[model samples]
Target chain A: MSTLRTLGSAAGAAAVVGGLVLVATPATAADTATVSVLHGIPNTPVDVYANGERLIDDFQPGTLTDALTLPAGAYDLAIFPADAPDGSGEPLLEADDVAVPAGANATVVAHLEEDGSPTLTPFVNDASPVAAGQARVTVRHTAAAPAVDVRAGGTPVVEGLTNPDEATLTVPASTITADVTLAGTDTVAIGPADLTLAEGTSTIVYAWGNGEAGYDLAVQTISGMHSMPAGVPGGSAGLADDTSSLPMVAALSVAGLAVAGAGVARVARNRG
Target chain B: MRPAAASAVLGLALAVGAPTAWALTRPEPAAGIPVEQALPAPAAPAGAGDLPALPTVTARDAAPAAAVAAPAPARISVPAWGVDAPVDAVGIAADGQMELPDDVSRVGWYRFGPAPGADGSAVLAGHVDDREQGTGALYPLKDAAVGDEVTVTDAAGTATRWRVVSRQVITKQALPLDRLFARDGAPRLTLITCGGPFLPEFRSYRDNVVVVAEPVP
Candidate 1:
């Protein structure tokens, strides 16, 4: 595979192939949904189909697809092992009657069930506006291990997170040291890595894999959804007005001269 | 000492007590801006879980990341208007609006938005005029015409050029915030300043002078 993976949309965020970067465009129109796919079952590389059409080819574990804009509705989804002939075979995972709401940002993942069986789970991503200098971070558990607590700076930010469930937090934008510990215990399960939460973005982190196979994280980012300024008070004086009279212009030149004189005097004082 | 020198100069200008023009366009270094607030504790956790075990991430654990990072903009200029100004990063102000620098000579880039050369609208705002000073760095923006060229230089000294495509005088209430501050779209440059009749009672301009520029590929 080439080192560079290109997202379909020109406006879409860039996606990192085998690591942790996936930027998405939020769905804002009322009739379409923005959706992405994450292949998270360890060592299981598969092809994904939606409504009998091939959507993702050779989708590998720990990788996330770019956001797809689809009309709001229900669709059948099927997954086949990589290189399966034209979606004709027994499927590894199937989800029927999956409903996608209009103007929603969502991600569907093929991950491990708590008992170690593979399953398909759909999650609606948060698309609400964030304040300036703030970011939204969402954590999803898709592994087959027991519940765990998510910690930032050694303190629990999320408690008792189980498989296929997710938690979200809106916090100031900064690089944070994060780790996952067994629920109510100090046993480190994952992390202690520094995650850069950029301002005005939603960063979704997925914990996927089974205890037997080992676990890993994949990150998806959604940009845009920053609050507008109350107002831009850019002009305090009316001098920029185009309709100023001749006298106003003359006075302005006088003021300019006075300012220039003041500047000269200040320079002289500095020399002294 | 700098403050005293500035006040003395300002005092002389005020003593003149004459009508002011939009001069003082030289870009000066931004000063007295407050430090950004520290990141607070994460907001309350929301949503439910399905399954999970912890995952350890390290430099050795994954493939090398190849994502592109845009440099921060340091200055902006327009040859058409003879305008040059320092760029300062600003976040939300105390009133929840985009913040602007106290000095009119420097332009404030909306730090939360996409940076220039990124695939989204990169917004920069500057004062059109100030009460203490005469004209602002962006005071000439109201007269901008289509085809004018704008150049933004990043901290790394890379300069990106843009061509003015449109200029509008929209009432503050009617400003289209969605397009002006869009997060996903073809990369563009958006410049803003106050315009229209100045309301002495409210001490503000009634409208915003918005200039949209497309990247010069």
Candidate 2:
């Protein structure tokens, strides 16, 4: 089940390259949805074919594709080995009629199932703005591991999350230590790592790799979804009452006096 | 301190003594166009079979969930304020300001934010007063007390109830924009309108009355 033990660091390097792609292409049309591709099969470099077109060549494992904004539609996807000649051999994995919704931000991950079979999973990224002082955390179980319980601060936050499944929760923005254990058992499987949940953002943690070889974790962030009133800032200072504030009352009195004085001046001028 | 005093003294000199300027304005709700038109087109209906089955989760747990997609608000009602108004979806204008509802009797739901019952704070704004119609639908929010029930009905007729948790009047400059517009958190609703003394000079109200409510139960 653990075929690509040596390719772990290479996958991390590919992710860095993917991050650069994301920074370079920041213009997405309003009507389109942003779709990113993640190659999770360890130790394998492959070419990705979408709708019969070779979209990515020599795509390394543990790497991500820059988000592509495409019109909402169905596209056939196929994964071919890196050395396989284009259009010549059988695909390593394929999914037909993969649907991409309009205006949704999503990640399609090609990873191994718990049984060590390769599969594709499409996850819709929640782009909804988080409330002030809050963040969203999502845990995706994509490794070849048993059903697991995800704990935050030593308590189970998500339980019975098996491979290719995910659980999400909204939490106060803070740094938390999280660990994964086998479902209903305290035996730790991965992590005592610090997870930073920043305000108005979604932090997605993926558990990858086989448990026997020690599972690995990857983090991805999608930000800028913060819910605030249209025009108000979150840190606004508010007035206690309308009429009683000393400054307000004083200002009103001054204005009243000014208007009265203006009236007197106009009357005097008329009499003159 | 001197600058602050100076500004106050100057304010008196320039005070025109006009009626308080109500900040809320009832612009004609985008002129006969459908309010939902301003929002992103609804995503394509997802096919049931497209999603893979969870390894050990039961069929019931696998059923498509309500939280997957937020439904657009169709109406809003505040029982304590005697407000029962149709909701008009409003988006940000070309000037980057939120568009106001055209109908003085209706409330404008910020379409860019989460829907009323979604995870984030859904915001609804209305005019305090209209030139011809007098008080706007949300004008009574000034008196909204804690525990008042605010119900939002989605297009699918699912009604979610919220209870007022806090209410305050804040100057426009001090308004918490992000909190009012947040799209993720414990589901909440924010009601806002013009408040405080109207400034005729600026032709707008000086403060905003904000009512924050959390989901019931």
Candidate 3:
């Protein structure tokens, strides 16, 4: 649990600067696409190849790669065992002539099918701006498990989610306790874990692994869709004005002190 | 001058005693998994893949270096104004407004925005004056002159310096939020506090004193 918390902090910190977005350079927007890779095939540490060239080496299960800015085009993609001498041998998974659209933000996953066979799935990510103070959370079911319901803070947000399928919701920014249960049943399958939905960002959670191996969660965050606050209400009293009356200041001073004393007392009460 | 001194005294007392009251009210820390470490070379080698043509990947102008994550800012100091205070992370309120700390002494750093040293505008706001706290730590921000330096220290104890570039007291309705809370641009530091006349009906100041600063080389 602590390890997950630490990892969360590290990832959160990395995107804290106004939410990092996988943006295509404006000048080349018509020619480029942004892509990230997630290796969710449990028990397999493999090398990822694109067009017969190794793009990632010894890629571990449940690991997600940083975004790559690639020119928009079609290419053969393959995955091979880590110890494979070259791309000449039969690949564990292969997809031919995968068309990558220009200016697209996508995630390609190597994961298990509903029947527990390994396969590849590409999903177009939602990067549109979310409402102010709200966050977008997308959940993808890539595990071999049966259909399930995803509950946030004890309320089911995604129902009857199936293998290689996804559900998305925009919610308030907060830390919520989330769990997955067998569809329409109280039987918990995974988690009662905490998920933080930060404002203006889209968080994609992947439920991966097979029924035989046990399921785990992986996360990918894309930021930069934040909206401005309606306003900043910074002051209440009229004390900052130069013409403030002496008698009012004196009166407020006493009141302020009393409030300060009460605050300290409240802290003491909380501590006790 | 007398009113300012009286308010300063009131501010000092609240600054010393008020942080604990609001600390208990903040939400829990959120969670995320560690970002993946392996990065592919920007482009595939020419003629490597069976495709119509060799596709090359290039670096994004707006993306930060994915390898090293910058730390969050923990404190801020403006020696010119004798302003130094701890910062608390804050987000948007349910009302679709920026949530300010209940404690007037501590500044609120907009968590969803860029951090102080990151490549965008980093916003730090404080109350100008409140009923419980007579004056805020950023009350002197309106008086900040161009060339004054504001220093922010991150969690790792690295202090980044910013030089005051401009100051403005615009009406609250006309606040240039897009520029002040920008997510993409050169690194900048933005300071905000209440100013102008306070309205009894609204219980808010009419204007916001905004200070913009650029990174100091």
Candidate 4:
């Protein structure tokens, strides 16, 4: 989960067990708990974790969602940025003692800020489908919270509501997928609009970036927009991997050492 | 000159300072909120056996072992279990991971773990149990006696054996940072493994039973 891995030659700690991509081994019995991440973060290094393990590490901001495999149990969920949870990255958005039961889904949304703290909210939305090349996005902050500036690409598109509970973004018909942004700080690549707009599809809208740490960003596609994924990409809707459970220092040191061990120990001006 | 010896091994139940709780985070921009709350209190996590063994590991993945021919650091003999695996000087992998010789998989020695005979706390680690594949050298560590002879080799190539003073079944979560990392400064060796009746469902041993060996010679 260290950036040094990206620069130097450090083999990813990603261990491929038995030749299988060691993805999250969800709880045996499908728990009713479903957790989704919607962040109002721009240009962030994702570090999402569940049950205290390094699951996702998208250490570069982009809007997306990823599902997790966990046994139904009480979990302490958190989100942070790459390179730090200690002042270097955003503050953690944690839901203490969240219970995930079998066959149920648990949805938790995190909003990011430049100050690096969190104001989390439990986002609830029904599945609505959207069509390809055409998009319908909705965002709202619960209980008259902060205002967030939403951007379509790098340009400002929609402003998050403070007391103005609902906001929406409709992409042009000639679009493939657009990057969704929260506030001015968070941005993510969202949607490969599927089907025809006239052919309405269901997309479950989950927005979470409108609070103190206000900017929980997520997508709410027109129902059935293309084959709607079980959840957003990049692991848990907008829940960028932003937790301290993953070691950044240890990883950086390992990478530096790997380079030094490779007979390049004299790369003076080394910055870990 | 070598540092002066501190307390006798038996008398030293090394008191390692509580490790500082380091908050882990990524390199993303903060979502824009103030963090006024003190970090959640550090916790010694439980339910370790339930955790998976580092998704995967090398059987003897301690690659590019340092100075292998340098005779075993000290003689490690688990009298009751009948193990007499010789300790050797190990080093970091080419990748910088603590690596033991691939030739001697599951053998324990104090690399950066603990020192052999110094004023500081030392460590000893061995494979919990192994044969050719299933079990290797530290196979009998599960049943080692209270007073088993565990010799540690000094940097000068002298052997200093210790007695297995205590055995503990510590979950991986509550790994004793002080004892394993040795911040308090005492010489010791911590034998380790994923052992106890092997759990088929879990695909690993019950807990890592550590045998703290103190210098006797």
- Among the numbered candidates, top TM-score falls to 1
lDDT of 1 by residue, A1-272 (tens): 01111211110111111221123336466566677888878988898877787777777888887777676667777789997787798888776556666676777777886778787766777888887668999998878888989999999999999876789999977778788888999999887667778787888888878777787777788876566666666888988655445456566656756666777687787889
* TM-score list, all predictions: 0.67, 0.47, 0.66, 0.28
Per-residue CA lDDT of model 4 for B113-154, tens digit only, reads 335555434544544433334445664555556666765554
lDDT for predicted candidate 4 compared with the true structure: 0.40
Which lDDT value does model 2 have at A223?
80
- Residue-by-residue lDDT tens digits, candidate 2, A1-272: 12122222122222111111111123234445567777777767888877788777788766666556566557677789889999568888776655555566877777777876676666767777666556899998888878999999999999999777788899866778899899999999988787777666888888876644557666777787654434621111122123425455457666766655666665556568
TM for candidate 2 is 0.47
Task: Report lDDT (CA) for all predictions.
Answer: 0.72, 0.65, 0.72, 0.40
- For model 3, the docking class works out as incorrect
Docking quality category of candidate 4 according to DockQ thresholds: incorrect
lDDT agreement of model 1 with the native: 0.72
**Lowest lDDT 10-residue stretch of candidate 1 chain A:** A1-10
Model 2: runs farther than 4 Å from truth? A1-30, A211-213, A229-272, B1-217
Clashes (N, CA, C under 3 Å) per candidate: 15, 22, 3, 112
Please compute DockQ, using alpha carbons, for every candidate against the native two-chain complex: 0.17, 0.05, 0.16, 0.01
